[model samples]
Target: MEQKHGTPIEWLMPLAFCTVFGWVVWHTPAFILDFGPENQQLAALYARLDVSPGLAPLFGGYGDIIDYGALLLSPLIFIGGVMTVRRAPMEFESWRAIDRVAVFIGRITMMLIVLLTSVMIYEVILRYVFEAPTLWANELSLWLAGFVFLLAGLYAMQQRSHIRIFLLYDAVPRWLQRVFDVVSTSLIVIFAAALIYGGYGEAFAKFMRWETFGTAFDPPIPATLKIMVLVIIALVAIQAVINLISDWNAVPVVHTAADDIDQDELERLKAAVGNEGVGELDVTRGAIQGNQSEHK
Candidate 1:
């Protein structure tokens, strides 16, 4: 019999790239001090973190952590990505279709967050300490930050931790909740699909020509990365479709009073006052009291 789930071959390239990149970075001093915008920002951050003279070496080595950590995680992410693609429920096939896009966007966002935060610090230090500013700092920050801002939506979808109001949702009946989930997820998928279809051509063209930020700090990082943004948008679109499918078949379980108010609630109440209530409040208490009062 054929296997129910099999690993995808597409993950190998990224996995290999991460492994080789990590090893070279770990071994080479040149890679650590490449002086490109990305590395410069990273180095500046390290310098700031070095408060004590003795800690300077440790702080300077922070870039290696990023390099090695990415190296280590890349393979795992690849494997997981494969598993996610292969083992993903048939009902959730839409997720597989768009998984790459979500990952690409998430990676870009994280890189931007790091780059911007570092450059902002670098600029502040230059202005305050040296009484001089660098053009590279501002340009670098903007370039990196732009990429990060673009990726946030993809990351939010991948993590499934996007903000949503759940307070009123608890009161919704199970079947209706499922319907709500399907509708919401479907809408997101539609929006993402539209974005990908409209934007992918331009994004791909940019990548094909090898566009650059035109900065002095480093060699042109390929515009191929921009393609990742398109890919991620596409993936998120697929994920939304899969989520809608999965949720359509899901049976929502009603939560009990105890679950509604737990230790966290007790802590909040205690912070507000000094005591805990003796028992859970009856949700139907007002109705019960009304019936008894009428009979009396």
Candidate 2:
């Protein structure tokens, strides 16, 4: 398969992610600084509950502006993220910009999963082997894992890999399939909209207060995750819309038990099993391929 090459713009997504997360990891405390003890004027701006003296100047008195700016420019971010995944082979022929963006975020989410696993492993080693477990590891793992679950949903939606009963769907005509698609997408949109409407106030309050998970190594899981929930659901809704639009004209697909098998995964397993194990693998693979063809 010929790979689609992206332009210089493709670098924007990764660079943007690095910059955001890097800033977040480093300047988190700084953003919630309380300069009131030393400077009265700066205190008014940085005033918040549970704040301490820190490097507030790093944000140059425009932290909120920068955040709002990013929100306004999210469409560009979406385009950049989409472009980042264009070089790879796509599983869906109907994949569009939103699908690419979902996949890109999903890839990032996968990296976070690795980091989460590493954190757990380190915690285990310290608790058992050294008996000096860190205070932050468990909380950090929970934080990362939560986002992973949220983001993986977007990827699953794009890949159509989420759990679904396609028995009725597969038997439907093209027009009925389109109706189903529209109805499902509308429901998704409504759910997201309702969630955001109901939760935005609380999310905004927590974010403004810069709430933290009260622990020895206090982390702002509450504040960040509250906002994250709304953001992710919005993204998922956008993806659902894009999926409906992109797949509107696509040929109706038949789903079966064979659809549960991943050919690529079978190939990987076969490769890893080697020549001695090839016989049984060949039989299973051949059967799967035939079933796939028969379903088609």
lDDT of 2 by residue, 25-73 (tens): 3234334442212444334433442133343333454245444344445
**Scored by CA lDDT, what does every candidate get?**
0.53, 0.69
Clash count list over all predictions: 4, 0
Error of 2 at 217 (Å): 1.8
Minimum summed lDDT over a 10-residue window in model 2 is located at 49-58
Worst 10 residues of 1 by lDDT: 85-94
lDDT of 2: 0.69
Q: Where does candidate 2 stray beyond 4 Å?
A: 1-22, 25-82, 87-90, 264-296
Candidate 2 pairs with clashing backbones: none
lDDT of 1 by residue, 54-155 (tens): 422324544345444555666665555433433223212224344554654343354447557877998999999998988678766665555565567655
TM-score of 2: 0.72
Best by TM-score: 2
| TM-score for each of the candidates | 0.49, 0.72
